[model samples]
Target: MSWITQKLPDVLFIQEGPGIRKYEYEENGYPMINVRCVQDGYIDMSSARCASMELATTKWKHFQVDEGDILYTISGTIGRSAIVKEADLPLLMNTSVVRFKSLTPDLDPKFVYYYFKTDLFIDELLGHSTGTAIKNVGPSHLKKMDISYPSLEEQKRIVAILDQAFTHIDKARALTEQNLRNVRELFESYLQQVFSLIGDRYVEEALDDACELITCGVAATPKYVDESEGVPFLSAQNVKSGKVVLDKYRHISKDLHAKLTKKNMPKKGDILYSRVGAGFGEAAVVEHEFEFSVYVSLTLIQPIEAKLDSYYLKYLLNSPQIKSLARSSITSSGVPNLNVKSVRKFLITYPALQKQKSVVRSIELMESEIGNLESIYQNKLLELDTLKKSLLQKAFSGELTKNMGEAAA
Candidate 1:
């Protein structure tokens, strides 16, 4: 039979219960699990929730995950999943998730999880997934997917190899993540001190005092063309937890690019803040000369190089407190929006150039250390993935050893 017709057991899962209440609500059904919890290979319990048992029982009973069950997302992130550890067997999953376990032991659950995580799997998943907003594929669609594997013992061997390798990857990633978090905390602490150190000596100045440019994208959505048009666009999506994610982005036409440059062209180090919706105050420092695609969702802050330190101001705006204030300061619009006139009123204490340089350098050092750790972790992660794919190829090709039995454990 052609590899396309191969069969294996297919299962489904879902997100259950509200992770958190983003808006007002009364009847508490099961808290919905969100994409946030599924990042990396683990479900971040930090944001999960419990809802009314009776309601949850009725609404989310469709997709129940058990211990060792592998849960994959059905929408948005398409094919992203996590192994249900021993602790979370009873928890209900939601509509966007699916649980799968192969009927044939030749398909190791761990192997499946790793396979789904690969660049190859992602490509196939995206190709099969439906929708323009967020990708999605139903359980039936998943069951129909052609997958081939090896003998049960061979599958176990591959899973064993992967588990050992990824444990190291996981630890390295954990350390890097910790370092990143620590740097963020350090920045916050030092910023507080900086703001207070210059408190009494502060100058009350207009935002333009430190400005080379301050504006937002056109409020109107003009004509848009695909990447063929040779225009690139940046949106709130580019700003992910204060970092720019250029991998998945949109493009526009050459004509539209010309029009936007006539408006506001982003330069390296300019602070880009979200101007619309729930992401109203989020910001990312521009790191490249990419063309701006969607403007209505952002506010650009270009600081005066001589008078204002753009890096310092960018960090200030990225602070959680400032973002909270910016979100609250949104005016009445269809959705909340951070207007240039209203938001620029945000004030920061100015210190002497030397002090400013000192703080910026400190933050820069912290960022570098964190960046190094992040690189190690990311590389380890890639290595683990490569090992997994190799193991899969071996197992299916009948080269993996099945002798890791009671003796190897």
Candidate 2:
């Protein structure tokens, strides 16, 4: 087998999109391909913005994206590539996404696109990239990068093998993803069933009447200190997956914590509810008796031990119905907020304390089972990804065709 190596620009033409201003976007027109549109292997135009024909023909006349062009994201979330098809026509490129075309007939675009999937290519691309937080690579950087390929015929053969292999791998991946979704849905469905199908022994009460206290945390920002010298501070971000995660928490001076906790101290069994921003409606139970001061973004709920189970209330708040009600009541004037008044007015349905404990146990058991299944499926997905990279490595290393020839012999 013979292979040729050259700089990317020597065999491919690379161009990125012009910066389209906010005012230029219209209700409907040519699909403007942004960085988001380029998925792993194909372009998804569902969320694409539009530019008018006037802009496409005038200022952006030469920026039209054609079929057979390979699109690569050159900015944040770099290294994703896709091939444009007929259905993706009349498309125009937006900033940060670059299109590549085969400058020579000897090179296959699909071959180069597949190479973009390899770790070798990604490592090289990142080596040429710049920036600390958000990495970026330009067409000039891509122009200087090297690409190695066999003859066009061999390239097509390798591409054919990859396409067939990936088709099966992708299908398996889709099914595994669906299974993961189903497991999560099962938990959610059971929660809905448990909450909705209440027995005659159950009673409904307002949250204000059920809990001893329903108040938010400190409003004023506190002075910061080193982790070893200060008290742990909890915020909405600390509450996730139905538990308080202190792994990435910040620290406040002990005096500030003392002042803050006087008004709002989180204790074991207290439920921390996210009140604003993206994490709103998420609730978690404080399982440990750790000293922590909460941020204003978190609402602390102290359930009356005799009346309500803290775990039960935590699960109830996270239920789909309660979440829906919370969404409806959220004040979106600024950040989406779940005010104390709104939370107090929420309806709480429960059975006897014994029954509540039983329900909690059942839900916890089911959650554990679902978590195990999720781990299995997640591992399967990782294995599939590894398999793909393995196949790409073999194909490019010439071992794939060599193995095929030996099998034929």
Which candidate achieves the best TM-score against the true structure? Answer: 2
Against the true structure, candidate 1 has what lDDT? Answer: 0.65
- What is the lDDT, from 0 to 100, of the residue 69 in candidate 2? 95
Task: List the candidate 1 regions with Cα displacement exceeding 4 Å.
Answer: 1-6, 9-70, 82-97, 101-165, 187-202, 206-215, 225-234, 237-271, 277-294, 302-312, 315-342, 352-377, 384-397, 401-409
Q: Relative to the unseen true structure, what is the C-alpha lDDT of residue 104 in candidate 1, on a scale of 0 to 100?
A: 54
**Model 2, which residues run further than 4 Å from truth?**
218-230, 277-279, 333-336, 402-409
Quote the positional error of residue 114 for candidate 1 in Å.
5.9
**Model 1, range 1-409, lDDT digits (tens) per residue?**
1122254343223223233333422244444455556665777655655555664566545545567777777678776678878765456665566667566544567867866766655676677788999887766566556565555565566677657655665676577667656756775676565555554554556676667777877677666667776676777766766676788766667777777777567778888878777767776777877566556777788887777677777666776557667877778667787888877777656676676777678767866776676676567667655665665455444555545222222
lDDT of 2 by residue, 154-218 (tens): 99988888887788889999999999999999988988988887688987989989988899988
Clashing pairs in 2: none
lDDT of each: 0.65, 0.88
